[model samples]
Target: MADTGELKQLPLKSLHEAAGAKFGGFAGWSMPLTYPAGVMKEHLHCRDAAGLFDISHMKLFAVSGPGAAAALARACPIDPRALPIGQAKYTFFLDENGGILDDLIVTRTGEERFIVVANAGNADADEAQLRAVASAFDCTVEPLDRVFLALQGPAAAQVAADAGIDGADLVFMQGKETDDGWFISRSGYTGEDGFEIALPAGVARAVAERLIGDERVEWVGLAARDSLRLEAGLCLHGQDITSETNPVDAGLLWAIPKGLRSGGDFIGASALEKAISDGPARKRVGLKPEGRQPVRAGAALVDGDGNAVGMVTSGGFGPSFGSPVAMGYVSVEAKEKPILAEVRGNRLPLQIHPLPFQPHRQRKG
Candidate 1:
């Protein structure tokens, strides 16, 4: 239980409760922690079948009017001007000091319209910054209250298509706004072929229920989401990536386009330029634990001589890999080799590995 008061419930709270979802507090939202099938089973289900997740707690902000894309590019490093219509890019909102404010998925919905899906905990801050930027332009920034859901797994697309949703033709990282007021995107946190839909409030439940009626779909919860994302090597905002972290140190250099990295009018351009020239002393890396015992977040990572170096940012049992997988910042010196994670005063070996502990099965066009 979190010390925070007044945990809000999702629009699908009643639906989740009826399906026996375990409860927990996530960003002031009383969200599902797990379900009757358990986290492990749900995790596997997302790999083999499809798992439905209520992600309405996450914010959806609309930025549009005129020159919206170029207007937004000032704060976000990614060139929204270059993002094609119907395509989405995973990028971060950087502060003036080059620190990551919040990572978000911004999808270009139209000629001048865009929708940003931000992390739940950082939604308020994200919108505030976006509003600050919009005040200088001819655009508007409005937060949305739609019900967001993730249909994740190998069978996610087929099931959603079978249910009459608009996802079968969409490629990875693509979305199209429907006349029914829902935006369907073929992307997910888990490294799988999936779709995330943002639906109107009135039809959210009906759409979700219809999809789950298929034999390939099941209700999942936050626990499975955490493990699935960890296996996918995706960073969890406020954890693996923080306000103090920069994209260079976070191993997300790929998100920075070549032209942007060298010179751009982006918010964090100056500081990121320095980081790129001097090189970040540390980098995010993946670790494979030697045994079945799981390494958890914040576990102390040490060097061979027991000197503290870094800490585990995300760690868990990878059901697909059938091994414990962990990821964290390690000194560049130890990044290419094995290291140790101190758990309960016992140092456990963590072999250095590349990301995506579970292979991604994106259905790219």
Candidate 2:
């Protein structure tokens, strides 16, 4: 655990404190780990109604200028130039070795401007990498000082409508800019029909208060957020996907359009092409441990004969699914073999389940 004293605070720290939030250190930020309702209740609440989350710790950046899209394309595997206005595409920043540096969402706001949302832990490094990639192009990477919020669940749309934020028409992966300083996206990590809103820090508190004041919306903390996203099969950067994980092995090749698969001038293109041709040594997969015991990360996975196969990266109980869930990487040959996770000096049987323990309810139209 990181020292809370040394962690940076969120802009809404006071608001969270007033709401009975328990603070913890995550990615150098003092963030709310759980609210009064607790992780289980909060997780279930989000699935049933609306759950509001303070995700201001994530880094927001505006990359604009005449060459913005072209330059961004050099850094990411996706072609930002192809992104239509008001649409966002999930993508990754890969190193020269084809390893993922960070996973981010890029929203095309204008012909030459885009908004990037990156993980807090990799914000600084991602910004530096973006600047370097845009150096030769007519682009400028400017960090935004704003408060980001996610309102997610089955009733999220109705809640947003009641809160005076009109997101009723925005389909999944779409975004719209309001005149009131709100950049709203119809997307979330929780695999629910939701909206991620970015607004000025000055108005964040009042806005949060108004939303939570609604009977349908509850304050959800990071702990429940992780469980929610895990159930949705979203990858956390430092854990499921990392500096050592490639798109092919991580099952993220879908992010790359078919047109860019054969060739592109992007970084790691050759390496990624080679990886696709030769196939990855290890592939990320979902694991369902037998029994009710949780199989945590760093636990070694083995074959039926106890041969080393892989290791768990992310693991915990899926509150919505009501079972233990995990994700890990395994050698291609061993991925199909019977697997077991070593927990507390005991080997536990595990089944290879499909990704996303919970069904995604994101709005399609």
Candidate 3:
């Protein structure tokens, strides 16, 4: 166990305390688990209104130099050369054996520069990998220990517009640097309209204050964030994907560029190509529990005969769906019938459903 007091703090730490936030240690940071209104209220708030989240613990980095994009392409499966400026793509960093090191978001900023955002827990490992790649390619990698904020919900666009930022013009996976010295991206974990803002550490506090000043916006915590992402069918690193899993089995084959499917060579390209040609043995699927009981991660997913076929990776009550939902990897053979999840030593009936449990309300423009 880690020491609670020794955990790192975010720029909005004081604000969280002032708002009576319940604290929890997450990814080596002391983060708010929920506010005074509680996790349920915060979860619903993001679905109906706007919810502000302190994502400062996420790692941000910038890669630059003449061959930055090409050099990064060698490690990542995405075709960076085709990614336009101001546009971002969800991709994976793969090991030599084709296992996923981490799934990341990479945005092309210029011919020679790009911005990368990665999970908080794997920040050091990601940085080390990038540094090694840069050294080999003779490029430059700079880590930005900045503050990041995610404003998510159906009313997120209106709130951002009220704050003098026009989110309607920003399409999904697109980002722009605002005059207020913040980089705003039309991306979020929740299946709703939102933006992730990256700003300097010094201005993070003010930005949070300004956004929360709006009556439509409330401060949310990690507890609701997890539920929102799970409802959205978004994969959580180390849980849904890891060094042992390949992208094809994770149901993220669309992320692989068309050109790379054949000739474009990159790290783990051969294995990924083979997996694409020959289907994976198992696949990720969503589960709708028959009763009100919520299944949990690591629970055994069994067939009617009581044979274990898969394991739940993420599971919870989907606030948007108003039911118990889960995601897990099941063998392709077991996908034909209604599966059963072993919850608390009882066989709970479950319907194998498609992903994105809640419909996405993100703006198309």
Candidate 4:
């Protein structure tokens, strides 16, 4: 068994236990794996209605200085110089070899201040990298170990609207502050309309209670979180991406800005440029299993001749789709046709399909 003492607790630790959550150690935190409703039910609930997730374990940091944007550009692949205030962009922290260290959301708050949200598992490394670069410039990086919540689903917009959130004005990848020291972003892991609210520990708990007070909202856990992200075609930090995977190979080439392509002197630009021009040896893709049994991560993919071509990174029984779905890398040659996954020592047929197994019905209208 994993050592419980080594696991960290979020601000809502007791509340999760009170709700009868099944716990698991994720990124050193004692996170809820699932609730009584189970992963399937919670996954469906988030797709159809609103589901509240305690995402407080994610690392929130603020970097401020006269040259903050330029300093950030030195560390990330995105062109922070062009990022408008109140806007956020999903980008990656590239290593010296052009491989991803972590994927993050960066928001420009002021002329000299920006807010960066990193993955919970890579928070320490991300902070260290940021500090190492920031030291050269006259900037201060402050890590906020606060609470965050993601309220996501088709009904998420309505819930936030009812709470006087003016969600219509907040477009995707945009953020605004509420009266209670809360930062609300119209972004989420599920392919649905939602908001990620970051606030102080005390106020975050209160906000969660208020949102859950509504009949439409239900508490979701990590199990559902994984399935939802898979259905949404989003990549998990350690699973879909790692220091071994480049942005291009992970199917995130769009994240590389045009300015950064040629003249941009960011870290790993040369390798990334080479990969962009030559193309990666293998690319990430989606798969739909033929049977009810889910194709889990590490499951091997074989070609028609039974040659190992790839492996599954994330997979599960998609509750919304009513079948098994998966996402992973495949050889460039295998991209044109159907592939098979080796599960339980048997070759199971799988069809290559487009990502986002489920459609996102956000509040765009």
Candidate 5:
């Protein structure tokens, strides 16, 4: 276990404490698990209003040089050279055997410049991987000096406009660096119409204060954040995806377009291309438990004879759905075969459905 004292804190740590946040360790950061209102309220508030999340633990990296785009294509499955400026893409870094090392959002800033926002825990390794790719091209990959925050919900745009950010016009998957140097992306993990703000640490607090002061905005912690993403049927990186799994198993083949320029010949591309055509042995799916207790990650998915068929990746009581929802990898045969989830050795009937237990509110524009 990592030492609590060694955990880093968000730039708004003092503010979070002032707001009565209960802190916990996440990806080596001392982040809030919830505020005084608690996880349930925080989750619901993000569905009805706007909830502010201090995601500064996430790392921002800038890649640029004459061959940056081509270099990126060689490192990942996507062809960054064909990406339009301001466009954002969700992609994964893989090992030579087609296992997911990390998944990140890459935003094209120019013809040869891009910014990749990586998950907190994988930041160091992600940097090393990007640098490894850099050796093959004339590019520089380095962390950006910015604090990242996520503002999500139905009223998210209004809250941003009310705070004088003037970024309500941007739609999903688009990002722009403001004249003030704040990078705002019209995207979020909650599957809502929202924005992720990357700003200078010095000024982030002021903007956060301005937004939090609004009636529609309040501090939400990682606990609620997890439930929100689970309800939306989104993957939570370390849990749902890892170096042991490939994109095909996680239902992320769409991120790597085979027909387009594709994740061609990149690291795991050989195996991935074959897996894409043959289909994975198992795929991620949603599960609706038959009883009250919610199944959690690592719970076994079992067959009629109590043989393990798969394992749960994420599970919890979805505040919005008013029931328990979970995601797991089940045998492709289990898609047609009746299965049960072993909960504390007791068998609970499982109903398989397509991903995203709840509706995705993310705007296509």
Candidate 6:
């Protein structure tokens, strides 16, 4: 949705078209908004079976050198040096003021090699910041252009097996490079168990065709992806989180290890430490509106006296949950009863429900 300057197409554009995709602009890419099955059906199908998505718009970077881990630690809060080979960790890049610059997945492929996957909107800035820090550590940051596909759902493992891809040994947050140049990881935006495959563009179409050939697999688009992630209580970088949001207030402290919280040295350590000690002024919480009407993002959260307390970041109708779910930031003092959301100039009754309207069925083992 950002500017859409000369939209770029993914490698599987033709395949999506064949699947009856309705295209729309997102982060300067002409991506599919939905297929013939629509967002509701696609969202439910993924929960029951498998949903294949083209997430190639995300940026991938290869950081390798003896100082790769050190370089990443300086830029991000996580201690990459402690990351085991073939393991991946979700973390964030922070500005000096402790605000999150972006959230990313860092996979340690080797002793001195890692693959950093960042959001598309922040790619340019991420690459620049990484390069600036990498140079000081004698590390090299190389941008990679490849096809990124996510196959997610309850039956995703069987579908991958049907395609002759051996990922049964991998659990959540684990990835390994195949002999044929494919990076298969047991991770996804959806809470369901699945694998994300990154491979060369030359064989992308063939691989997608092979996967979708199964009866259980269906092509999904951005619309369903957003709803699915919302149901899973996952945060979208630019929307739910931004450069103005810090890890503590955003409820992302779990992503940062305790060691880092106590004594770690990183870009935003001081600010984060202070926030932890002082406590967050506002905390991210789940909102359950009373009616069937979906509460979209940017809706203001107010108190009984109609005073603005917080704002909704991600909100929508969850297909699997069968209810309108939303997540937003609320002031700590205003985290009281009778929280209302202003809809069409009318304050509607809502409750502070726990996050993740649905349970995460991730294959942790």
Best by lDDT: 2
Instruction: List the pairs of residues colliding in candidate 4.
Output: none
**Candidate 5 lDDT trough over 10 residues, lowest sum:** 257-266
Scored against the true structure, residue 185 in model 5 reaches a CA lDDT of 89
From the highest lDDT down, the ranking of the candidates is 2, 6, 1, 5, 3, 4
State the lDDT of candidate 1 residue by residue for 1-117, as single tens digits. Answer: 664258888988889888998889998798999999999999999999999999999999889989688777886888888889999988889876678898888999999999999
- Model with the higher TM-score, candidate 2 or 6: 2
Model 4 per-residue lDDT tens digits across residues 1-365 = 36678888888888888888988889988898899999988988888789999988899888889878888988888888788888888998898778999999988877787889999999999999999999988889999767899999988888978866555677778876556556778888888889888888876666777888888988999989988989888999899998899988999988878777653667888888888888888999988988888899999999888988999999887888889999999999887766899989898988887988998766553
All models: lDDT?
0.89, 0.92, 0.86, 0.86, 0.87, 0.91
Candidate 3 residue-wise lDDT, 160-219, digit = tens? 988876567788888866555567789999988899989887877776888999999998
Query: Which sections of candidate 2 miss by over 4 Å?
Result: none
Distance from true location, Cα of 211 in model 2, Å: 0.5
Residue 319 Cα positional deviation in candidate 2, in Å, after optimal superposition: 0.8
lDDT winner between 1 and 3, please give it: 1
Runs with alpha carbons beyond 4 Å of true place in candidate 4: 1-3, 164-168, 178-180
TM-score winner: 2
Q: Write the per-residue lDDT of candidate 5 for residues 1-365, one digit (tens) a residue.
A: 34569899787889999999888899889988989999999999999999999999999998999978877887788888778899999998888878999999999977778989999999999999999998899989978878888999999988898788867768899887766767888889998889999999889889989989999998999999999999888898898999888998998888886653233757788878777777789988998887778989989899888777899999989898888889999988867877888888688888886667778887677
Q: What TM-score would you give candidate 1 relative to the actual structure?
A: 0.97
Off by over 4 Å in 5: 1-3, 260-263
Q: Which stretches of candidate 6 lie over 4 Å from their true place?
A: 1-5
lDDT of 6 by residue, 317-364 (tens): 999989999999999999985799998988878888887888999999
- Per residue, candidate 2 scores C-alpha lDDT tens digits across 1-365 of 55798899999898999999999999889999999999999999999999999999999888999999999889899888788899999998999988999999999988898889999999999999999999989999999888999999999999999888888889999986666667889999999999999999888888899999999999999999999998888999999999898999999999988877766878988888888988888988989998999999899999999999999999999999999999999898997789999999999999988998899999997
Q: How far off is residue 68 in model 1, in Å?
A: 0.7
TM-score of each: 0.97, 0.98, 0.96, 0.96, 0.97, 0.97
